[model samples]
Target: MVSLAPYVLKRPWLTKMLTPAANWYASASGYRQLGLRYDDLLEEENEAVQIALKRLSAKEAYERVYRIRRSVQCSYTHKLLPKDQWTKPEEDVPYLRSILAQVEAELAEKDALDSMTVIKKH
Candidate 1:
């Protein structure tokens, strides 16, 4: 994946300029109003997501399910969560991203090991 996050983070000026825009975009995306974190928007069909879900603590997993169910209920009712109940910017952390990254790294490492050739040293 070619992410510009690293490049943006490397330049203090760019980070400063984009931070507010990014925050505004995230808020405008409406998931927060549904009380769902950014990580909850990730698709669940992939193996990495499955692994990441499994890696979540019981509380975190339950909370994730609750958010999804609540969001669905809101969708059905055509309503947004009350202001106080909305997911705060600070609360919209990337809970699954770290675990997903770890899973990807492990899969990559496994692939590397599997593709290794044995060299016999006499």
Candidate 2:
């Protein structure tokens, strides 16, 4: 659970310095051109991701699958989405990351509670 985001965010200078480079990296990664959100690239084999996907609204789930399938089709055909169809930076939100964070937090809380010892004085 050691995330560098908090550390980077805490330093405004660092955030300012890295924002453009991060955006450039994201754009260069080409998922956007394939009409895929950053979250769509996340590994689906993990329990946390599975729980997160399950928590998504039906529409969101359907859209996620559509994006993945479309991206796969694009890969098969060796084509990128049309320029107009590329995912806009504004539209590329961390939908799954927030839910995954919540699920992980709940799991951690459960683990903590499960390991707790109770003592009673009569």
Query: Which predicted model would earn the best TM-score?
Result: 1
Cα lDDT of all candidates, in order? Answer: 0.94, 0.95
- What residue pairs are clashing in model 2? none
For 42-119, candidate 2 gives per-residue lDDT tens digits of 999988889999999999999999999999999999999999999999999988999999998988899999999999
**Residue 60 in model 1: lDDT:** 95
What is the per-residue lDDT of model 1 for residues 73-102, given as tens digits with 9 covering 90 to 100? 999999999999999998888889999999
Stretches of candidate 1 above 4 Å error? 117-122
User: Model 1 scores what on Cα lDDT?
Assistant: 0.94
Poorest stretch of ten by lDDT in candidate 2: 1-10
Give the TM-scores of the predictions, in the order they appear.
Answer: 0.91, 0.88
Model 2 C-alpha lDDT versus the unseen true structure: 0.95
| Candidate 1, number of clashes | 0
Backbone clash numbers for all candidates listed: 0, 0
Q: Which one wins on lDDT?
A: 2
RMSD of each: 1.7, 1.8
